[model samples]
Target: MRVMVFVKATEDSEKGFAPTPETMAMMQAMGKYNDELRNAGILLTADGLKPSSEGKRIAFDGPGRRVIDGPFAETRELVAGFWLWEVKDMDEAVAWVKRCPNPMPGPSEIEIRPLYEMADWQE
Candidate 1:
């Protein structure tokens, strides 16, 4: 199974704050964890995203489209980064996530959702 792991954004992330010593340490820990995932052949790809201030959004409604500037509100709903991973099952993915280092300076969240295969759409 393949899963996408979402790293939820925090206020600091949305503000594009500089990294602190603790954040540096956390990065190191995350590196080690990523190494483990790579060694296990589970990690496909991963990367952090720039703050929403540097992004753009497109809204669609009934064949109409509008471009919205970034610096969007609702930091709690923003995504800071993500990981694409292949695992045997959701349980395995959950286990791997449990071993990951904290990706933020304070409270944060990681959401794992399975990807839909083409077969899923077949009758």
Candidate 2:
């Protein structure tokens, strides 16, 4: 099975604050862990995203009419990064997620969701 691990962003992340020394160390550890996954042939791709302020959001209600802006609110829980991984099952994915290091000094949240499979439509 394939899964995406979402690294939820905190206010600091959205504000472009760099990770602290401890956080950087944790990230390094996580990178090593990801390397382990790659060695085991599970990790596919992984990367962190820039601050949301660097992105834009577009809302389209109809053809040729749209509103575009950025630094959206209610984004406190948005994903700051993600990892694409291949695993055997949900349990395996969960185990891998549990091994991730916290990305922030405060509470850090990681959401794991299975990737959609074409076989799902065949049934």
Candidate 3:
């Protein structure tokens, strides 16, 4: 099973707050977890993302086009980073995600979802 682990964004993240020393240390711990996953042959890829301010959102409708810039949302529950990992099942994916350090300073969240396999689409 392949899973996507979402690293949620915070208010400070939208305002371009750099990671604090404690946050950086937590990230380092995450890196160690990633390394362990890789060694166990589960992790496919993982990385943090730049602030959403650098991103662009495109909207299109019937020949009308618009592009909007980010820090798009005022919500704290936005994606800031992600990890793609292969595991035996959803349970394993959940276990890995459970072990991750909180990625944000306050009220952070991580969402883990299994990726759809092509075989699942076959009927």
Judged by TM-score, which candidate is best?
A: 1
Candidates' C-alpha lDDT: 0.93, 0.82, 0.81
Clashing residue pairs, backbone N/CA/C < 3 A, model 3: none
lDDT string for model 3 (24-99, tens) is 7877888888888899999888877778888888999989999998767665667788889888988888887787
Ranking by lDDT: 1, 2, 3
Query: Which of 2 and 3 is ahead in TM-score?
Result: 2
TM-score of each: 0.94, 0.88, 0.87
Q: Which lDDT value does model 1 have at 98?
A: 95
For residues 1-123, could you state the per-residue lDDT of candidate 2 as single tens digits? Answer: 999989888887788756678767877887888888899899899988888778876776766665555576776568788999999999999987887777666887888998789998895
In terms of lDDT, the best-performing candidate is 1
| lDDT head-to-head 1 vs 3, winner | 1
Order the candidate numbers by TM-score, best to worst: 1, 2, 3
User: Whole-model lDDT for model 2 versus the true structure?
Assistant: 0.82
Please state the error at residue 14 of candidate 3 in Å. Answer: 2.4
User: What number of clashing residue pairs does each candidate have, in the order they appear?
Assistant: 0, 0, 0
Where in model 3 is the C-alpha error above 4 Å?
17-19
* lDDT score at residue 74, model 2, on the 0-100 scale: 71
